[model samples]
Target: MGALALVSAVGLAVDDRILVGVPIWAKPFKFSVSFVAYSLSLAWMLSLLPRGRRAGWWAGTVIAVASAVEMALITLQVVRGTQSHFNRATPFDDTVFQIMGGTVVVLWLGALVVSLLLLRARILDRAMAWTVRLSSLIALAGAAVGFLMVRPTPEQLATDDSPIVGAHGVGVPDGGPSMPVTGWATTGGDLRVAHFFGMHALQLLPLVLLVLAALAARSVRHPRFPLLARLADERVRLRLALTASAVYAAVFVLLTWQALRGQALSAPDGATLAGAGAIVLLGAAATTLSLRTPLP
Candidate 1:
């Protein structure tokens, strides 16, 4: 995956070709880097398993294979200077898209298996164990979010010869104005925003635990801020983990809701702000309660 990322980066620099309003190599470059992070995280999570290590490892292998296939097909499309996703311009193009979709399904199933194993296995830390389990399940849901694009949009349905069957954009075309680097639509709802955030819960939730532990360790010798020590407590960490996951899950839902309503992320309406404010307020309340909970 690392090598693929490097190659795609080189392609991005060397190739001036544009497809779907972005640099042709952009998708491959981003997907490769994402796969590198995902593969490494899953491998480490598998190592944390006590009894279900074998099952987790098997699932990890399946995910690795599926990721490789997906990346390969995406890179092939990049080389051909065509869109990899939702492209049904020709029979060959449709077949490529179908195969890519199949790989995604395989990848989701593999993650699901690992998630179930994590639910059954005990890890070194209580917080991280549950974080892994919950994040994995959420990540699976995030992966499923990609399926939303598979359904043909109204415009595509109206057009008799639409080359694409679906799109990432809700009210606008996929190749329209987008944010820098991320390529998210700037004028309309982009489902990729929700999908990206949701799929990364596995990385983000564990990061919350690490940050908490690091802060505790850094303040171990401090006379002030004695509450930092609570982060070292297993019970405290577990409660905080749950709190963070709840807020994270809520935010994911909010983004999905915003996109489905054809709202641009940067221009969220009153409803969007209300949903976000609710998430923040609730998260703050949950955090305070977690801190007040007795730790033994």
Candidate 2:
């Protein structure tokens, strides 16, 4: 899947035509990178699960095929010199869009099944298990953000000539002023911020625990490291992962809230700041309690 995406990206880049406001190749290029990332992350996560390897493989296969179908449709639309998403400009385009949407739903359902399997099984390391479970849930939450983009905002319905419902930017129409490269909104709310953060939680949460585990291992030999260096026990590491996961989930929710309110990522008001502070305080309290409590 990753290889196919890479090939498609290279092909698109060489084409070098502009579509809508950006390069025609940009959509495939971005999707390729995302597909590679998601594929690698899912593969690594499934490898960590105990038992159900066959089931995991089936689920992973479904996800890969569905994602490839989505990428293929997007690339096909790009080649046709038309919009891939929220585009019902013609009957054929509408059919393609529906197919892509259905593929995404299949991918999401496959992920949910794998997550359920991971949650029910016992892995070798408690910390790693918690990380897998938490990351799966977070990633799923991130995928849910796509629905916001799929459904048209009230502004879009009132403004767009077509019956198609789609808009990426909140409080402003899509394709307005956007951030460089990512093209996320710079003047209004962009749900992609939360979506991006949420999608990578699978990689990020495990990475945090892996780093902490490495540090703790090193401290055992050196003995002069910081307080967290002493957290060599599986239970201690699990607690830490849980605490960090809680904080991470809170930030994801906060970003979604901020975007829904039509506030740009760069322009948070005092109230937003206050809300962030509260989330931090609550996370800190939870972490402290986790550290103090004894495991059964």
Candidate 3:
């Protein structure tokens, strides 16, 4: 599951066109990898259920079906062209993808709600249950925001003011003049912010919990006074703290590099770096002060 999620994460973060003659509307390999990963992950989660009716198979089946439908909708959209604007007369294939992709999300939400109810009533104590539930809830919140931002009105593709938001492609020439076909990409939807927050919750939430777990382990490994006689035992907490700090540092640096590539670094990036530096320094100081015994 971790490996699959990691592959999906890479795909979601980077866009690569591996297939030729693919429509621009189609998602690149990155998106496809993430989609496939999510599908497989969901199936694995279902596999964890005990044999027989110990778990609510009905609810699980519904959730699984919804998940599959969601994937299929996305797949269809990538393979088949979808019309951006409904007001404009569109071909049959175009509207089909729109309905499938949009409506399947609603079904997914319904399935999620049912699954959550089942979890709270009968499965909350299970290992990793809370993490799955919290992650799904966070994702659902982001999905809600995205759905609300969508335009219900039919779109006007010909007009400069599009009824549909987030449409990007080539623009036609105005008046009777003929000009070369130029691509014009629009980014007003604020979709990226929501997606960035939502998709990453899987990583962010787990990392948060891992940090907390590390802190707990630190306290257990070293009480008020260190075990001077047993150097290995004495330094366990410090080791755990350092390990966690290193992982945090590496992920932050990767993020910084990404921000640089996009030229999106600014005061916020600087502030984050400063905050991370403070954390590492404080952790180091605490570890050092707790272990200063002249190597007894």
Per-prediction RMSD in angstroms? 1.3, 2.2, 10.6
Residue pairs clashing in model 2 are none
Q: Judge candidate 1 against the unseen true structure and give its global Cα lDDT, from 0 to 1.
A: 0.89
lDDT of 3 by residue, 9-97 (tens): 46445644332223333343334454454444444444444443434456556545654554455545444443332222344545654
Ranking by lDDT: 1, 2, 3
Which candidate would rank higher by lDDT, 1 or 2? 1
In model 2, where is the ten-residue run with the lowest total lDDT?
225-234
Against the correct fold, how does model 3 do in TM-score?
0.46
Q: Model 1 shows how many backbone clashes?
A: 0
Best by lDDT: 1
Summarize candidate 2's per-residue lDDT along 1-296 as a digit string, tens digits.
56666766686668777765567777777778877888888999888777898999999999999998998898788878889989887889999999999998999999998899899879888888888899999999999898888887786667756746787778977777777788778789999899889988988898999898987788788787556554776777888899899889989998999998888888898878988999889888877776666466
- The local distance difference test score of model 3 is 0.42
lDDT of each: 0.89, 0.84, 0.42
Cα lDDT for residue 38, candidate 3: 47
Give the 10-residue window scoring lowest on summed lDDT in candidate 1.
Answer: 223-232
Please identify model 3 stretches exceeding 4 Å from their true place: 1-30, 36-60, 73-77, 80-89, 101-103, 118-133, 152-189, 222-296
